[model samples]
Target: MNEPCSRLAGVAVHLPETTMTTAELEDAVEARSPGVRIPRGVLERASGVRRRHIAAPHELPSDLAVAASREVLDDAGVRPAELDLIIYAGVLGDTVEPATAHVVAAGLGAACPVFDVRNACNGFANAIDIADALIARGGHRRVLITCGELLSAGIPWRIRSTEEFFAAGPHYTFSDAGAALLMEAGPAAGDGPAGGVLATRFSAESAAWALAALPVTGLSSDPDGAPLGIGRFDYDSLRFAAAFNDLDLEVLHKPLVEAGLRWDDFAAVCVHQAALPYLRAFCDRAGIPHDRTVVTIAEHGNVATASLPLQLAEAVRGGRVRRGDLVALVGLGSGIGAGIVIARW
Candidate 1:
């Protein structure tokens, strides 16, 4: 049987102008946890991230998505009217009432079908999978997949414990960014990209779901008491880090093997930017070249669902990726979910 096929038509990305450095994060963490000690250099050396971009106080996910979608359409020479579908894949939403996709689509002047995919950090890969399916089914000629993450909004400023963790090196590294990819059916009458969608795989260890959960607990206040919002990261996140690290390898192996390829077959691998330590451990276990693995966590921290696409966009913009290269998009995050998509671009 022939493999499925899909092709990337175009790509574009946007990063906020504001940046937060490792030292700044450390100071913030220190202020929250006076006794906690973390070496700033450890963050940089381990994460390969020097700084991360953040949105302004007034900016929302839809705002970033609009900017990014425009750039992508312009680069692809595609007009808003030409888009058949728009999928916003990210954890952050413009509002709890209305889907952020509607707002972003309107902002982009797109008068087409629009929706969202919430798969945490793996959202982009999941979006790609959905777009590919639509093209395969001949239901859509062009599908626009966009992701926007505003991770800073979730930070608890009031709680010293939560505040310190946000101030920690990882938090400073966390950034706000958006990315868009234009995907269309392959040149031939096939479901896969011309080069082929070799294989796609996903895995999850449900028992480990609580590893990186955000519980809706009461606020943790800074020196000046103020009501910090709900949803704070559980410090015990470190405990499940090991489980995710192990799952990363398990997830990649299945698709790779089914595709009759090895880790060395791909020119580059785009994994979710969870954190510095977990990423390193995954790389070491997989035996994939660390240099080939794109790192964004140190700078962008963990952009939840937007991380993978943002990393892919960076690699493309930096000229690190080119035509006919075997690229892997791997996603791992809450839900303890992990997915892999092999793409030829």
Candidate 2:
């Protein structure tokens, strides 16, 4: 028997009402460390993020996911009880035990097989990949993957000096947001590649995992452990950027090769956006058309695992992507991993 095609059935996103501008963050930096000589506009110039959504202190990461999940479930007209599986894929969670997926499931009153998938920023894309496989092989008819990222919670608001500023700068480039995507089995009522997910490819460079992290060690400490405590944003952004200096285009080429498609074939490509410059650089390195890609880094900031779908939602709403339109989701996250999911919207 042939594998049943799994397609993106619905998508929804939730952004916190609060916002923090780059200039405001810079002001806070200078206010906290008066002696530091961090220049204004430098942060925005480098990060390409002007502002980002911020969750309220009372909001938990699970809340973000639940909000979006409810919207998606309603949009898809699929009841919680009808879902075959549920996956909470994100970097932030309410706690360590009980699995964040369970929180999301309970929030929606969903009673089905559920789990969590955490791969730093690539969590959502990877979750979609896993759900696609499960639907194709496990006979699960409907799978929901949700991501809730409180990336701002990791930001070290108090900087002591310029050196400290640059090292922790990566923390400021993100915003808090929730995203939910529904994948359903079987064909659709469109002309999109005979229905949903067409191809997916994943690659990892584990050795380069040290590029960035916000570790919370229980009993032990890392060799280069973050002395500042949890959410330290312990990474040298400069070295990390240089690591991708020699980026090979194979991350993208392999997908096209396997799926028998071309770069131009996609209506809009949604690449992970930790920052605007990196997104642009990756596109340039991959030779993908500049206009063909969506730009959310500047406005949304990096929404972490929710980044791809947020951009995708914007594209579809704006008419840049239509039903049956072919779209590609590219992910590049801290674990130093990459993945591409080709689906017909």
Q: Candidate 1, residues 59-134: lDDT per residue as tens digits?
A: 9888888888899899889999998999998777786557788998899888999888876677788888888877
Candidate 1 accuracy as lDDT: 0.74
Model 1 regions more than 4 Å off: 1-4, 27-49, 156-172, 188-193, 215-230, 246-248
**Cα displacement (Å) at residue 186, model 2:** 1.5
Measured by C-alpha RMSD in angstroms, how accurate is candidate 2? Answer: 3.0
lDDT (C-alpha, whole model) for all candidates = 0.74, 0.85
- Compose the digit string of candidate 2's lDDT tens values, residues 9-102: 8899999999989999888777888688777887899899999999999999999999999999999899999999999998888877889999
Q: Measured by TM-score, how close is model 1 to the native structure?
A: 0.84
For each candidate, give its TM-score against the true structure.
0.84, 0.93
Predicted model with the maximum TM-score:
2
- lDDT, candidate 2, equals 0.85
